[model samples]
Target: PVKDSTAAIGLTILLFIIPSKLDFLHAFDKDPTKRPTKPAPALITWKTIHEKMHWSLLFVLGGGFAIATGSTDSGLSTMLGESLSGLKGLNEIMILFIVCLFAENITELTANVAVANIILPVLAEM
Candidate 1:
């Protein structure tokens, strides 16, 4: 909602600071005996990175990028576009509608960024 760039930056900084301050406050106990005696775990420790993180999503994203790059490099997308070029004769509105439908379906199968990377170049060539 902030219109000024400086105001937006200040708001973002505050957003991060406020939650962190609150969390730090909550970390201490009213009874000294109940408080943590040792330092907290490091942010980038192997336990945090390997055990806590969900890594499957990263693999899926990497696969999507690989598929996009392969399709482009192999010229499969260009061939696909040329094969579908007959659709160019249709009304512009209909073409838009069909492309949107195709995109929606493709996104259901894979990540949207991957689909866009693969489809946009083909559409551009067409």
Candidate 2:
């Protein structure tokens, strides 16, 4: 949050001075023998490059299709429809805000798969 240069400098000084007297803690000390003998040579291989390119595209396409499939399921659609019914009594804007808040809260506590599975059937029923 240090915005201005002067304020940032002052904060930096304060932080460093306050921490100067504290002892430093570390998980482990370095071992010289374990260090690599030479800098690793730059990798240059068609197979390695091809594998990375291949898998990246494969996984991306696979995940995209899986998400699309999950969203359009009939039971899930029906459940969502049921839950979304009966909005006639409430203001549309307020309803949207409330629904967004509720959904955010729910998503925070549940995984995507669990949330989708639970809501899909319920929505379809609507």
Candidate 3:
């Protein structure tokens, strides 16, 4: 029910911290009707953790966040806006369409939210 970022992060952390003991792999019986009242003890192992964790994806997302933070901190977002000032003579629709294409291409290589953070400021300044 909560839409707050802090709440979202807390809930995500809770899934790991609170449910770390649940043996989800062996939670239910093989038969469709046979079910355990509670999950078995967790079978924690390095291999299991490795298999379950999205480690590489986490780095990629971190890099995206870093890129967005860096661009904002370095004033590149504002510079982009200023640079686009010269293109004022161009059709507004064309300008937005071009920006959208650029954003979409960057997003294909990284994360869409990161690209949005990088590009939204430029559009706002315009």
| TM-scores of all candidate predictions against the true structure | 0.56, 0.33, 0.57
Off by over 4 Å in 3: 1-13, 16-49, 104-112
Of 1 and 3, the candidate ahead on lDDT is 3
lDDT of 3: 0.75
When summed lDDT is taken over every stretch of 10 residues in candidate 1, the lowest stretch is: 17-26
lDDT of model 2 at residue 43?
Answer: 31
- Give one digit per residue, the lDDT tens place, for model 1 in 1-126: 557868976865555445322334435678777555555443345554579777988788878888898888998788778876988899988988888898899899888778888889877876
Predicted structure with the largest lDDT when compared to the true one: 3
Off by over 4 Å in 2: 1-68, 106-126
48-125 per-residue lDDT for model 3 (tens digits)? 768999998888788888989998899987888788788678899998888888887888887876888888877777
Evaluation by TM-score, superior candidate among 1 and 3: 3
TM-score of 1: 0.56
Give per-residue CA lDDT, model 2, range 35-96, as digits (tens).
Answer: 55544333333454566667856575555446546755546545555667775468868766
> Could you tell me the lDDT of residue 114 within candidate 3?
80
By the TM-score metric, which is better: model 1 or model 2?
Answer: 1
